[model samples]
Target chain A: MIRFDKISWSAGSFALEEVSFAVPAGSYAVLMGRSGSGKTSLLEILCGLRTPSSGSLWIGDNEITSLSPGERGIGYVPQDGALFPTMTVRENIGFAQRIRGEPAAATKATVGSLAERLGIGAVLDRRPQNLSGGERQRVALGRALASRPQVLVLDEPLSALDEELREGLARLLKDIQRDLKLTTLHVTHHRQEAAQLADHVLRLENGAVVRESGPPQNG
Target chain B: MTLRGSRWFWGLLAGITGAYLAFILAMLAATAVYSAPSDLWKALQSREIQHSIWLSLCTCTVTALLSLFIAIPSGYVLSRATFPGKSWVQAALDIPIVLPPMVMGLALLILFQTWFGRLLEKAVALTYTVNGVVLAQLVIGAAFAIRTMHGTFDHLSARPEEVAMTLGCSRARAAWLVTLPAARRGIFAAGTVAWARSMGEFGPILVFAGATRMKTEVLPTTVWLELSVGNLEAAVAVSLLMVVFAMIILVAVRRVGERV
Candidate 1:
């Protein structure tokens, strides 16, 4: 579970005021908002990349507001993937486990399996710069899942893809979320994307969660 | 709206660039033609020339390594951090670069006479010693290296390092494992430029480290020594040697750096 209580932050002249919301355990929540509506800032704060002026952040029953990003046990996939350009795709996916001093065999195994599962097995040895947009996004997803965190935060995971690729990846994302049963907060401005992947939807407007609703019955 | 709309505009730009290249090449060519290959060959065999060449190479190498050692941290800090007086700090770092070579040498000459320099000299002699040659070159070389590093770090995105942090690595590890490796090309470029700058250093070495035969004398000092004695042929030969050697090393470094 991921929860934020009374989160308020001041960035330049813009303010996120008294924002409170929760994503229940084993559920996918989509936070929808227009550009510059503080959606990215909220995700950044939750990922521990930035700090909220006044707030408490909880992940899986533990208060993680004061913890470092590495200690938060939260996987974050930023908009551009942000892969380490010095390494191959295989190495990028295996980064967390390698840094944590996991056995080489186990790390290699995780890289191999994640590569296959993400349908990027053919490009494991290739660099991020050489991959297609959708392939890069899958590499990023595999990288985040390699750490096996209890919560995941995605910022515009499918915004850069074509309509067909976007729909295909949306279905893949939903399947992965269901299989992992991990609490998730995906930030996007696409209403169709939200309806397709979100079990619950939270609308952020004017720096607050103005509405909450379940997916459409047909969806 | 477009600079290329007129063909004369492109021709004008290319004209000045070609003229500049021609002038520089002519200067180097004049030096090469002044001494025949045989005179250059004979001068290269002289003991003084040999000693000066060896001394210059060793000092320049040490100066390059030290420049890199200091440049990395200084560059990283200047690029990434915000402070109360950042502009002033940047200006201070530029002092070595902007100071006239003679003034820098005079400052170093006086600095070694102070209490701290006296203490340091007791450990390893710098004033008028072979090590003093390195000190003089480092003053300017490190300044250039730091500036290069500062720009290099500035151009690199912090995104990769941030992602590394989220991947459970500390900030330091992320820099070492991600950022530094990514900066390999910049490091090579900085080191090569520092080494090249050190090879050409002349005025500072003359003022700080006196030209002592087979002792503190570097190639630039040897040039001065030869000119002082009115050995015009030898002086021109050594000058030409410095140019040729500098060119060869520069081309080699560029190739190796590109491969890396």
Candidate 2:
């Protein structure tokens, strides 16, 4: 479970005012907003990338408001994937483990499994620069899942793809979330995506959560 | 086939570039040709030349390494962080690059004459010593390194470091694992340029370290000493050696840069 209680932030003229939401464990939450609506900022705040001006954040029962991004136990995939350009896909997926000095065999096993699951096993030896947009996203998703964090936060992971790829990945994400029972907070402006995958939906306007909806039935 | 239109225009520009290259090569060739092999051989075997060559190599290596240590953090801050008087800080970093080498040397000399420098000197002698040579080279070389690394970090997005942090690496680990590795090519380029600049530095060493024989005497100073004593052949030989060595290292570095 991920919870934000009365969280607020101010960056220049933009502000997130008293935003609050909760994603129950094993549920997918979609945050919808127009451009500059503070959806990304909210995601950043939740993942400990930005400090909240007030209030608290919690992942399950643990209060993580004061923790650094690394200590927050949140996996964040940014809007552009932001894969390390110098590292191969295999290395990129295994980065979190490698940095923590996990055993080589374990990292390889984990990375191989994750890549195979993400359907990016063939591009393991290639760098991010050599991968297509969709391939990069899969590799990035694998990287984020490598550490097995408390929650997975994706910022517009499917927005960059073509309609055909987007639909496929959206379903893929749902399957991944359901199979792994991964708590997910996906931020996007696409209403259809929210309808397709979100177990709960929240909309943001002017940096505040303005609406909430229960899980949508199958389309 | 007859060249026409933009082809001639580009050819003209290429001709100008070729002229510049030919001019530099001819000047060096003339010096090398005028110097007798026996004279060049004698200069190479001289104890003073030997000492100067070794000193230049050692001091420049130390200077380059020292510059990298300072540059990494300095460059990251200069590139990534926002602060009051940032423009002023950037300008200060660039001052060494623009200031005359003699002025820099003079500044160092004046600094050592002050109370602070005197206190430091008590800890370890610097003025007119080989250490002074290293210090002088570091000042300018670090400026080059900082500039190179600043641009490098600027060109690279900071998102990877943020991603690393999200993956449970600390701030330092994120830099060590992601950002620094991403900037490896730039680091190599910076180090090579700084080393070359340190090797060729003369005016600062002349003023601050005083070209002392068998002590502070670097390659540039050795050339000066030979010329002063009317050993034209020896001076020319040393100059050729420096040119060749610098050329080889620069070419190797460029190739490595290209690969990256």
Candidate 3:
């Protein structure tokens, strides 16, 4: 489970105040909000990219508010993948394992398997600059899953793609989530995307949270 | 006979560029022609000239490296963080670059005469020594280096390093493994700027380090010493030598771009 308790944060003139919500384990929660509606700020709080002024973040029963970003056990895929340009896709996928001092052979095996699963096996030796948009997103997903994180937070992961590619990758995401039983919070403003993915929905408007069990009704 | 808008634009641009190049070549030609070939050879072979060449190379190289020591962290913080008085701190870095080099040299001379400076001097003399040569060069060199590094860091996005942190790498580790490698070209450019600036530095060294024979004499001071004694040939020859060094460094920086 992933939860934000009474999260209050203000930056410059924008603020999200005392926002509270939860996404159950092994389920997908779509956070829907329009532009300038604090969705990215809320996502940043969940991913440890920003700290809420008066709230605690919980991931699978652990209070992670005091943890540094690296220790928070959240795997985040930012809007454009943000892959390390210095490393090949293989290295990018295996970064978590290598960082934790996993044996080289095991990291290599994990990278190989994950690349195959993500359908990026052929491009494992290439850098992100050479990747197509879909391929880059897949490599980013592989990188996120390598650490076996407690919660997955994706910020507009499919927003960059064309219509066909977005639909295809949306299916891939659903399948992977179901296969791994990973709890997730995917942020997007698109109503159809929320309808396609959310087992639960949280809507943000003027910095408040409103929860619904399924796709939102027309505004 | 006729030119369109694009043609006229290109022709004017080329004309201006050619005029500038011609002026520079004329300056070099004048220096090259001022002295006989034998006198130039003798200047190269002279013990004082050779010593100044070695001293200039060693001091400038040392000054460039030390500037990086000051520049990298200062640039990184200045680029990345926002704090109280941040703008003031950034403006302070430009002080050395904006001030006359002779003023900076005078400041150093005045500084060493103070209590804290005297206490520092007890450890390593910097008033009129080879160490002073590096110190004088460093004040100007580091300012340029810091600005270069600041621009470099500013252009690079912080998103990749943040992603590394999410992947179980600590902030410091992320910087080391991700940000630094991406900034390699910038670091090289910063070092090149510092070295080139230090190579041409004269006013600071002449004011602070003093032009003692075979002691603190660098290429610039060699020029000054030659001119003061009315040895115009030796002065012009040393000027030519400095130009040759600049060309070599230019080629070297370009090679770094291609290879590294």
Q: How would you encode candidate 1's per-residue C-alpha lDDT over B32-116 as one tens digit per residue?
A: 8888788878888999889999999999999999999999999999998878899999999999899998899999999988999
Which portion of correct inter-chain contacts appears in model 1?
0.68
- Residue B213, candidate 1: C-alpha displacement in angstroms: 1.9
Q: Model 2: which residue pairs collide?
A: none
In candidate 1, the residue pairs with backbone N, CA or C atoms under 3 Å apart (3 or more residues apart, or in different chains) clash, namely: none
Give the residue spans of candidate 2 off by over 4 A: A99-106, A212-219, B1-5, B8-12
Candidate 2 lDDT tens digits, A40-59: 88888887778898999988
Q: Tell me the lDDT of model 3 at A204.
A: 89
Relative to the unseen true structure, what is the C-alpha lDDT of residue B117 in candidate 1, on a scale of 0 to 100?
89
Which digits, one per residue and each the tens of the lDDT, describe model 3 over residues A1-219? 888889999988888889887888878999987788998888888777787899888887799888888888888888999999889999899999999999999999998888888899999999999999999999999999998887788899999999898898899899989998999899987788888988988888878878866643321
In terms of lDDT, the poorest run of 10 residues in model 3 chain B is B1-10
- Write down the lDDT of every candidate, Cα atoms only: 0.89, 0.90, 0.89
Shift of residue B138 alpha carbon in model 3, Å: 0.9
lDDT of 2 by residue, B119-216 (tens): 99999899999899999999999999999999999999988898898888888888888999899998988888889999999999999999888999
* Cα lDDT tens digits for candidate 1, A1-219: 788889999867999988988888888999998899999889889988888899799887799999988999888888888888889999999999999999999999999988888899999999988999999999999999999888989999999999999999889889989998988899998999999998888889888885468733221
DockQ of each: 0.72, 0.71, 0.77
Restricted to chain B, the TM-score per model reads: 0.95, 0.96, 0.96
